[model samples]
Each structure stands twice: as C-alpha cells, then as structure tokens.
Target: MAKLDVELKVNGEDYKLQVGSQERLLDTIREQLKLTGTKEGCSVGECGACTVIVDDQAVNSCMVLTAQVDGSKIITVEGLESKSGLHPLQKAFIEKQAVQCGFCTPGMLMSALALLNTNPEPSKEEIKTALEGNLCRCTGYQQIIDAVEMAAEEWGG
Candidate 1:
C-alpha cells in the first residue's frame, strides 16, 4: 500500500498529511488529527457516531476515504465551539439537557448543525429528517429537538 499526500481543512485549520488508501476519514480525524470528538461506534456506516461535516454537508466519516476528501474542508464536533465561547448549538444542548451517555451527541450535533446551517428555521419534521441517520438510546430525542430549536432561536447569525 502506498501513502498519498493530502491536504485537509478541519476545524478551521489546514493540515497536510500522508494517508493510506484504505484509511477512512474517521481514522484521519481521530488518529492523525487527534480530534477524538468524532467517535467511532460502528465501522460500518449504520451508526452515525462517526458523523462529520464535509464541504458543508453532514456525512459519515466512516464511509469516506481520506483520499476521497483531499482538499475538502471538514468540521468535527470540536469545530462547533471556538475561543469566544460555545456555539449556540452547544449551549442549547447543555441548557436543554440533550446529552446522556454522550456517545451519540457528537453525531447528533453535527447533523443538527448541518441542517441549521442550511435552514435556520427548520420545522420539527425537518429536524427529525436531518437526524434520521443518528441513533440515540437516551433522551428520546425530544430534548435534542428542543435543543436544536433553541439554538435556532439563539443563532441564525
């Protein structure tokens, strides 16, 4: 196997790395970039635990090859917050008590972020559709939905 040189912009930072052909974006983010905020629940794409934003769209990091996303801008859970303060989504998640166990929170947040980025005022059904891929065993999704709604009210900037 040969290593491919690639450049990726993640969390507003650009990185040039040598990646194997078989390396998944999830591995690149978690291992090479050390952004463990994107968890790997199932290597398969069924579990949204490895979700991240690639080129403004929410995608499963486990489903994409690192080489496939070369030169792409990606956003992980870490990217949602900044030095100024927590992103509105983060604040809403905490305020609404949307996190439990936290295994699925990162993916859920990423999905919600993608949706809100495109549609600041998404309907409840829209929120559900955006989060359809992410599975959460806790919270029953009501709090998460509420959190997204709350973030929409606070954000939209």
Candidate 2:
C-alpha cells in the first residue's frame, strides 16, 4: 500500500506523519499519535465512543480516514485540561459522579464540549440531542446530563 503524508494539528500541537491510505483516524490517533482517549467502541460510527472534535465539530474517529483530515485541527479528550485545572466538564463529571466504568467518559466529554462550542446554553433536551450518538452502559445518562449542565453554568454559558 502507498503511504500518504498528512499534516494536522491535534490538541493544539502540530504533527506530520505518513499514514496508510486505508488508515482510519481512530487508528492514527491511538496507534500513531498515542491519543487513546478516543475510544473505539463500534467501528461503524454507531456507539460514538470514538468521538473527537475536528474543526470544532464532533466526529467519530472510526468513520474518518486519516488522509481525509489533512490540515485539520482535532481536539480529543486529552486536550480538555489546561495548566490551571481540568476543563469544566471534567470537573463537573467528577463532582456529579457521572463516570461509570470510564469507557464512555471521553466520548461524552467530547460531545459535551462540542455542544458548548456551538450552543453554550443548551437546554436539557439539547444536551440529550447532542449526546444521542454516545452510549453509556452505566449511570442511565442522568448524571451525564447533569454534568454537562453544571459545566455550562460554570462556564457562564
């Protein structure tokens, strides 16, 4: 297979790499970039566990080809924190006990961040809609919703 060279920014860092034409963004993120924060649940874009922010839009890493993201900017769960502290959503999730088993936390955070980027003051229903793609096997989702809402309030959204 011919390797394609691509450049992209991830979590505010620039990177240049040679990727296989068939490489999925999920694989590049996990294997190459070592950003395991984006989970791979359903590879076909159903579970939303592989969600990441590309150009400020939430996307399923599994559904995107690495070459398709050349020159794009992506934000993963790993990028949510800063030198000051954890992102508001992360803090809220901890406070609300929204994480269970930890599998869905990354995707949930990505979706919530994307929601805030666009609709900072999302209503409960809007929050639910934004997270519809993500599936949490634990907590039944109320805590996640509460976490996002709390984060929104904390961010003055």
- Residue 21 of model 2 has an lDDT of 90
Write candidate 2's Cα lDDT for 1-157 as tens digits: 6699999999999999899998999999999999898899989988899999999999999999999999999999999999998999999999999998999899999999999999989999999999999999885599999999999999945
TM-score of each: 0.96, 0.97
| Candidate 2 TM-score over all chains jointly | 0.97
Give per-model CA RMSD. Answer: 1.2, 0.9
Which ranges in model 1 have alpha carbons more than 4 Å from their true place?
A: none
User: Top model by TM-score, which number?
Assistant: 2
What are the per-residue Cα lDDT tens digits for candidate 1 across 80-107? 8888999999999999999989999999
